[model samples]
Target chain A: MSELVPNKSIYEFYRLVEEHHILLAFQGMMTTDILTMMGKNLKEQAEDHIFHRRIFSVMVELVQNINLHSADKAYSESDKKMVGKGIIVLSTSADGKIFTVASGNLIRKSEIESLRQKIDHINRLSEEQLRDYYLEQLRAPEDQDSSGLIGVARRAKNPLAYDFIHVDEEHAFFLLTVPIHQQNSDK
Target chain B: MENFSIKGSNYIPTVHFDAKSGVLEISGESYHEYTVEFFQPIIQWLREYLATPGREIVFNFKMVYFNTSTSRRFLEIFDMLEDYQRSKKGKVTINWYYQNNDFDMLESGQDFAEDVNLPFNFYTF
Candidate 1:
């Protein structure tokens, strides 16, 4: 991968995506229009429109979260100067069955605690529990940004895999990954 | 009441609902920046329809894709029908259609059916 793209920025990441069979990659400045475009692309590429739709929707929901609610905002065009800036990538496994969706973004030092708790809560849920969580969030009023992460877990047919890397300046780079969990099993 | 339609985008689901026919169809992909914003009016319309529904409603979802936020909203529609089915019993039927080749769709439809306990008929193309 490194020999293919010597540069470590965009070239390296995109190369990694290709090698790993990453489906969709969302890095740098995530906007509504671009998110919408990504959704359409997923629909076109997916075997199951519903499955594709959910992943696309989750991407839009979560990435926009970084755009809107991130405590750190980077004001730049080339790279993310925003505090809550990050990237999301999607790719299929070698088998072409298990789809992996991964998102990485920066978060405030203070916000990390809450985000961690939320992720933990989601991870703890069974499918039924996640459904309950989703229902609980839905029954309440709208405009709540908190449920977006939980919604991803709830909607996932397979267990959501995640990790966090703490960068400098009281900012943590969080990675949330989900696998479709089938080896072309048709489900 | 008010009729609206938003077609499929790369990351958002396709929306096609008919107010007059009381037949709602949501299919294709879904991943949008503004979920609640996009779905708000539709939810409201369902609320309105429940108040004075038509003779029969056949809600069909050929959704092969939907995220958690959208999933929650979909549940709302189902719950509405189940509740509506109580007083307005047997007036609504939700066809949770999926491609025969896809196991995810079948399981997903079954999951929703189990939650609502409604006979979500699974159809194959």
Candidate 2:
């Protein structure tokens, strides 16, 4: 390997993240310990108690989903083990009125259609319908589907935004974005 | 039966099941990576304890935050309690406590109450 200096690349990435108004960002292996630490840091950064809790709840669901569903894997140096790899970004609107918790992870191509349908279905439900649907899903058998995303939509009280960036015939990068309005935050 | 107690951490809830007193409680946060595995022994213990007939069980859930998977385990526990109560085997009451001003927590308790047949009482702390 040739010796290389990448200070410019580092600064460029920093500028890019800063330009996005990102409050917190992580890209690498996802694990329970890392999630706990990230949650604590995010909570401490927020001034409003309720706001922090709501955002924390959304973040937990998104991060854990990555841990459970992401098809990409990477070696975590600190953990000394391979774990799911993903990216999570917490950003706020320019007006500081809304916060968005977004995550990106690679997933198998076959899973994209079902995921799309699930998000579309969740987006269409009224709050009451969502609650009823959530409770209904809770009573269903333990299948790795539906409940978590429904919880995210219910807690957000807003439509979930998502995209599937096709990478190859067998895989795609899945991105999920959940928005939390500061005004509607009673929890 | 031996009393079952597991101390909590930042990611796991503290579970204390007093077989003698028949007051079972799970408090604190539960976002364990292996949530199903974590609750297995606790559920198994409840199963064995309920095998003995005519016992009154009071279940308290005071959770600060729990992941969706924990919610499923909670339902499993509730189903078990419902079964125990329905068969004339035992008397069961569930007390769900949520932090003051945390309506989400309160609603979570309510949703669980709606799903099962057991009697439920909600309290704000």
Candidate 3:
């Protein structure tokens, strides 16, 4: 019989991430405090000022989406709060010319279609159009479900790549990736 | 009415609205879980103040960062100010202060300025 070694698998996973130049990665319950701390860390670590602001802004919205809309919730050490469970990863390209932020969380199957539609709509807009849409949404009445993904698209200045994997009858795993190109100093 | 002032927390902004001075200021970062709930009272106070607003009102915003939820609330406040201005009740001025190097914050101020019909004075620190 083959031996099942869990420790080796865990070690390999970490080794893979380290080799990829991952700046930060977290998988588990996400809270506002944790989000703030992560933002601070990223701000301090990012070499480019513009990239820091864009990434920090985009990360805040992404994590907030997970916190507010994730179907899966886990109890934190403090019983007073219920944290949302999700995964967020930030990594740099092998050439060190691009940074990508990726996140995934469980969402209700019923909401996946609409969410997909919103991302598609955002992906199709021009930068000017996206800015106009963002302003329009800002003026509109509050919709809790809307995380203002257009704002994310504007900051990223790139298409939002996303996918949905069916988890079960009622839930699906939603994954989103945003790529921010690092501008050369000469430009 | 009594003046309202709440010290800023890690996730919520500091709100200082002085009834006597007619100087309303919101500063710091805001990304509260229940954004609307936290700002509802402040909105109410603004409404009440506008009913019999003083001669001059200056609203200052010096926010380092805020989530989309908080941005919506800000639009609401701007809408209210516009309404007050349309009524010609008093002179309303908005001071949007941003860090000198923070272009995003400057753009946010410009966005708000475009949406509302008011004299939005932008200051860079």
Best by DockQ: 2
Q: Model 3, A8-46: lDDT tens per residue? A: 898998899989889988888877777778877887896
lDDT by candidate, in order shown: 0.68, 0.87, 0.83
Query: What digit string (tens of lDDT, one per residue) describes model 1 on residues A1-187?
Result: 4565456677876778679987777676666556666766886887755556556655766676667665556665432334345787888778776677777777666777776777777787787777567657766665554567765665555556666677888877777786655433433
Candidate 3 structure quality by residue, lDDT tens digits, B9-125: 877899999888889999988877567788999999888888984458899999888878888889899988888887857889999998777777887788889888989999986
Model 1 DockQ reads: 0.32
Interface alpha-carbon RMSD, every candidate: 4.0, 1.7, 2.9
DockQ of predictions, in order shown = 0.32, 0.63, 0.47
lDDT of 2 by residue, A1-187 (tens): 9767699988998998888889988888888888898879977787876567878888888987887789998776665556788999999998989999999999999998899998999999998899888877876776556788899898888899999998998999999999999987774
DockQ of model 3, rounded to 2 decimals: 0.47
Q: Which residue pairs show collisions in model 2?
A: none
The per-candidate TM-score of the B chain, in the order shown, comes to: 0.85, 0.97, 0.95
lDDT of 2 by residue, B1-125 (tens): 99999999989899999999999999999887667788999999999999988899999999888888788889889988989888857999999998887777888898888889989999987
Task: Score candidate 2 by lDDT.
Answer: 0.87
At residue B33, what lDDT does model 2 achieve?
A: 61
Top TM-score prediction, candidate number: 2
Query: Which model is ahead, 1 or 3, in terms of lDDT?
Result: 3
